[model samples]
Target: MKMADEGRRGEEDGGPGAVHQVFVVMESLLEKLKVLNYEEEILAKHNMKNLSRHYFVSSPFLAVNPGEQFFLFTVIAAWLINEAGRPFTAPQEHDEPNATVSNILSELRAFGVKVDFPPSKLKSGQESSPNYPAETTEEESVIEDDAELTLSKVEEEMIEEPDDEEENVMDLEALKLRTCPTDTEASSKPEEILEATVDAAEWSLEVERVLPQLKVTVRTDNKSYLDRLQEDVGKTLEKAKERYQQASGGVTERTRVLAEISEELEKVKQEMEEKGSSMSDGAPVVKIKQSLTKLKQEIIQMDVRIGVVEHTLLQAKLKEKSNMTRDMNATNLPEPATGPFA
Candidate 1:
């Protein structure tokens, strides 16, 4: 949610510093991609360069799949910085925010890491009720401690002056007055309750304002990552399918070729045997043996190659079958404002 606002401001401002920062991010990403023999085919498919300018300026990543979008964001962030003519810099270090339960949950969602942050036990409809602040038993305990401190102070003051009987009696009455509710006090209870209710209503309105906007942020973030993954993996899956088919069909053809080679070897062996008994020199037989040996080795090598291809083909299919569900699940935020902090 916090990053969402920064992103918008970066686009609108588009100052030299902002552009430079973005170009640096994109350039850094491209460098990493180069190391991995990565190609920006996703950009080419969209008929656009995966530059930080257009991407940060707009949501072009959404048009692609998750991996592609992720590549664009993570890698392009560095490139944008470079393009803006800024010197390369590493991500700056800073202390993280206080580790509140809410902040932790939000970070998990942002990073697309799943961790269950279970909510505290609450009365039905209590969470949805706005007039009451979302607090746990711990908060109530804190308030109860303040109440006890107030009572202790009153008791000490009473103890400090009790030599005069009338004064002591008056003090007792005052203490009772402080402890017990009179008619006015009882009547004012409704006003206090009303004020509390109004406060809760305001809190509800605040949550309403923040939560939906956060929802939009989360959805867009998830969609961009997903789009890139789908595009990259989806393309690989398709290519794998084609390779699998070709490899599968080629296996039969290769086996037939091997059989033909075997038949030729047998014929050569027979000819060598028939000619061996009458041959003055063994050169013909030796030549036949060498050729047969080479042919047999070639068949063995062919089998190994086929086996490798089959394995590759199997892996591709499994990867293709793997859906984006688990990958996407990490971004699924716990029901808004319902975790421990909420």
Candidate 2:
């Protein structure tokens, strides 16, 4: 649990929100890469450019190919995993990003680094898990020892000795010589010491004479330019805010009306789509087409029947005319007698 808490703290400390400290993490990553011999193994082998300190850092100001960054991140991660005695396959350019990130996180967790962030954060190759290199254990200890020794040496050098000028300024030997009595003074000092001649009242009067001259006074200014400027700025800001409000008073109403219009349009569009779908699925059009086809077939049959009836009537008319002619020929003697009588 303690290790987990430490790992979480480490992750939070190195998280993206700490933008100022990202360089520290990047530097650590660069050191780890150097320890892995990336200069000879990765860059030289691939004929790639040297990695910058911010190579894996995501920044809006830095334009980089995300595909290349992700691939490089995967390659380095796989190499590190292999170096840590784990057999891991390096990802390719066309590999799924989520899968690659998951695999890397799995391997990182296998090394006991707790990862709580989502895989999407790693997709840009900006955030990398902390790497613990097995080969650097002894080297790190030795480096730390050397650093401690160097620090101790620096501290020892920082310890300053007393200067001759400071000793002269103190004059401790002179003070001691004046404080200790010599042999001649020790023998004659008891009766020959001088007594005070001046009065205490005179000394106090002289001190009072110079008291006003020794007193100091400081004057304080109440009017500050910064305070005046602040008041002016505040008034200007208030006037600007009032003017802005007046100019854009109808903005909220316009936005609400536009939103309402958009909602109505969306409703109308949905209704049209529903109507179109219903018409396409309905049977009325198909039934109407079938009805029209049946009527056409019935009209064609009626025309055929009318033609047959007309042909039969014409044949009967022709037969009647022929019979009439034959009857006139058979009765030719009666017709000649009538003509003679006429």
Candidate 3:
């Protein structure tokens, strides 16, 4: 019984969340590709397999199976390298006939890979080879060792970890024994843990199911495809520039309109000031008329205010009457010691 419980616990807690992570990686890839205007021909030939091939072949340290979804990150990394207009660093042997140097380059950029170039060389357009081949150095050797050490530590932790005590305290007559509090708690933990484990299992199953259906969505390798995207981008930039010019011209026109409005407002203000000065010369009837207009507005506002106050008062009276009626009707009932028992 203890062994069964321990097995269940191991299955639950030991599960990895790789499915969700893969989905995230796939979704990110689509998002990055959304804005890119790929030529139809180029898009026709593009597949995840070939893309992975391009990636793993380039990076010496990385080896990925072309058919698997798990290598999406690596493919993205490769795509980033190409997009930034860098030379294809993947070994020449892995290069396919259809894979243009730019496809690999553009994919890397699409994935938002940052390649550090010397500013001085960049300004001069002078390309320099990396001192280390594909991100390896002597310190990385030590880091690798450290990684192995950490992994060994984790394995040791996994092996030596103490089992939950309730698992060992199983009733011999499992069917006859009542559900104990400790057993209930232990059972509850397994349900929650099992949920997570089941989710991973379900996701893996889904990936397995869907992977075969993912008919290698071919991507464009044609030079015209990149050219087309570049042309589209150029046209877009031109349109943006034209729109900016038109917007700038519109802003100038708006500024002129605003200035005219300002001048008109000033004229109106000056005219009003002149009329005020004339009125100040003891025009009693004009002042009386203005006072009468203000008085009429005040009277209107007061009427509205009075209406609101009367309505509120009526509502309050109605509520009071209803409450009183309820109180009167509530008599001859059992009275609790507490006041206002409902």
What TM-scores do the predictions have?
0.22, 0.33, 0.23
Q: Stretches of candidate 1 above 4 Å error?
A: 1-220, 280-342
Residue 45, candidate 3: alpha-carbon lDDT: 35
Task: Estimate, for each residue in 210-247, the C-alpha lDDT of model 2 and write its tens digit.
Answer: 44345454443457767888899999999999999977
Best-performing candidate as measured by TM-score: 2
Between prediction 1 and prediction 2, which has the larger lDDT?
A: 2
Tens digits of per-residue lDDT for model 3 on 141-170?
Answer: 233344455556655655666464344343
lDDT on C-alpha atoms for all candidate structures: 0.45, 0.61, 0.44
TM-score-wise, the better of 1 and 3 is 3
Residue 297: error of model 2 in Å? 91
The candidate maximizing lDDT is: 2
**Candidate 2 C-alpha error for residue 115, in Å:** 1.5
Q: Flag the better candidate by TM-score, 2 or 3.
A: 2
